[model samples]
Target: MNAVDSALCEAFAPSGVLRVSINFGNPVLATRGTNGEPQGISVDLATELARRMDLPLRFVTFDAAGKSVAAVAAGDADFGFFAFDPVRGKEIAFTRPYLLIEGSYLVRSESHIQTNDDVDRSGVRLAVGTGSAYDLFLTRELKHAEIVRGSTSPEVVNTFLRDGLDVAAGVTQQLLADAKRLGGLRLLRGNFMVIRQAMGVAKSRGDEVATWLDCFVSEMVRTGVLRRAVARHQIGAMSAPEVKP
Candidate 1:
């Protein structure tokens, strides 16, 4: 049983404050608010979690989920939102995923690639965010297409367009936005993958936070809290699976 009290403060609320990693590049889950503060579904959830724990909330911003993962793993941030990937699993412990986002490819409108099946060819070049979940997945799955890693997620689309790459792979929402903004680009008919969004604490941070966060996330999904945040942030109807019993 988890205690509502700060009996486990050291694990989650170190320094009498809970520092939440805000991955602002993940447009589906986070973005900058009107006031230039971190504002999005993840921010709301993190804030509520801190409130419930009776701790002051502190925001630690990261431009990429990989950076946030590294920060949390290095014990620089208390916890962060991340996609559940085996590669990252080695370094951090993940809670059950509460949200899922589509991962797909975008290509030049005049390109021969019309579907997801066309993306794996020998000459295809895909641009991906270095250390992103899609990059890790494609690095393992893409046998022929070459992957070029940009410095971060938000830069991937520009890197793809600038380099004349065959495809840009990342969160589908980001791809859609790029297609709308950059023009001359379109998303493949189907998704290449589904990114499972979850929270993680560093393995070095101990098992207590992991256990507590797992329960907290499941509750957040089961109740309407997670849904409300999604609606409030206008994050779109990506996908929210019921928490496993």
Candidate 2:
């Protein structure tokens, strides 16, 4: 990897430290360590980026993606991993995705919601993490279903069960774990969406910072940095295919 240009460092770490936002809500990218610290692919990527930039590293942790995105957009953090969403793009500039995570729906075993499309019917209340990629996407796409907001992705199933919602939507891995843990729940047959998870800095960081980040991610994909991170973490997500910059 090339030495990070001084200007690039200035742009990414304006406070003289690289503050990376880690969202533990997405189990496929991050999880709480035994010591209560953040760990997993997101942390590994953030650490690697800071090391390459030679900046002092700091973590701004959140339990939900919305809070993580807010921290980056509000300049409380320098960069964060996020699912690509046009709604969030208004405040963030993202690289090409480094990972693809499936989004699916979970339903009670006796529920009539047997397919992803069945989730869109009127009177069927669906629970989703507020401001999640799927939340933003389904809000726009689902014409009839009433969307209930879960406090966090990991809690969506709990919210669904608590309120007796017809469907619970979130990362497939998370839903699968929830299904196995709670019993009598099963995920729909197919994914409703593929979340393109990528690293992003606030749009206020300027195009130069965005370009550098994009190039860095493309290199990570090409050189297997992302693949190794996924393998090391043993997460369910797949590394995104390399894309020409």
Candidate 3:
């Protein structure tokens, strides 16, 4: 077995507790329900990781992606389950990507903006959650679009739904799930760019932990567990990295 597998054997050895941090913003990661309990792909993955490690799982919620990164940096969380960005990487160490993702534009189904060219028009405003990876990507890539930044994804979505903006940019998975609920919004045909999703651990923690997480992630992908989990959550339709090539 690999070092990560060995670490798992030790970490879960009937007496360890692995505290992982998760964000509720990303459905593929963690999110809270109306009842205020944790739910979503991140929760599922954390639970599974705990099961494999035979350890207990604890969750802490944050309102922003930056705060989630802070939690890991402050040692309040052993690791974080969220999109890993290079900017945030400076604050914390990241595991090898366990999954891949693509950014997308979300707009009302009835909206006239249907293609990439449409989004570039002067009047088309793009809403995004402040400090989100999507916001970062949009600021960097969609230079021509006016950005209407919100503090949360729901706020951003609601603003767009109310016609406060012409379009909103977000993770393709979130847009897809929300589209089912709103019934009037649609994800654009293509993605802005692809990103890798990995776990973030405190930099103070030795690289051993990050190395183990990377191995665990690699194992999950190789064994098809990661793909299975994505399908189980009905998020398989979202774009993921082309298998290591």
TM-score per prediction, in order, is 0.95, 0.98, 0.81
Which digits, one per residue and each the tens of the lDDT, describe model 2 over residues 55-128? Answer: 88998899999999999999999999999999999999999999999999999999987888788998999999
Give me the candidate number with maximum lDDT. Answer: 2
User: What is the Cα root-mean-square deviation between model 2 and the actual structure?
Assistant: 1.0
Backbone clashes per model, in order? Answer: 0, 0, 3
Which lDDT tens digits does candidate 1 get at residues 127-220? 9998899999999998989999865888888998788888888888888888999798888888899888998888877787788889889888
Candidate with more favorable, higher lDDT: 1 or 3: 1
For all predictions, the C-alpha RMSD in Å is 1.5, 1.0, 3.7
Candidates' C-alpha lDDT: 0.85, 0.91, 0.72
Name the better of 1 and 2 by lDDT: 2
Q: 16, model 2: CA deviation in Å? A: 1.1
Candidate 1: count of backbone clashes, pairs at least 3 residues apart or interchain: 0
Runs in model 3 lying further than 4 Å from the true structure = 1-16, 33-35, 51-54, 237-245
> For residue 172, what is the lDDT in candidate 1?
84
- Candidate order by decreasing lDDT: 2, 1, 3
Highest-scoring model, TM-score: 2
- Model 2 regions more than 4 Å off: none
Model 3 TM-score, 2 decimals: 0.81
Worst 10 residues of 3 by lDDT: 6-15
lDDT of 3 by residue, 36-153 (tens): 9887667766777777666777887887776788888877777786677777878788776777777788888788987866897677788888888887776777657798875576
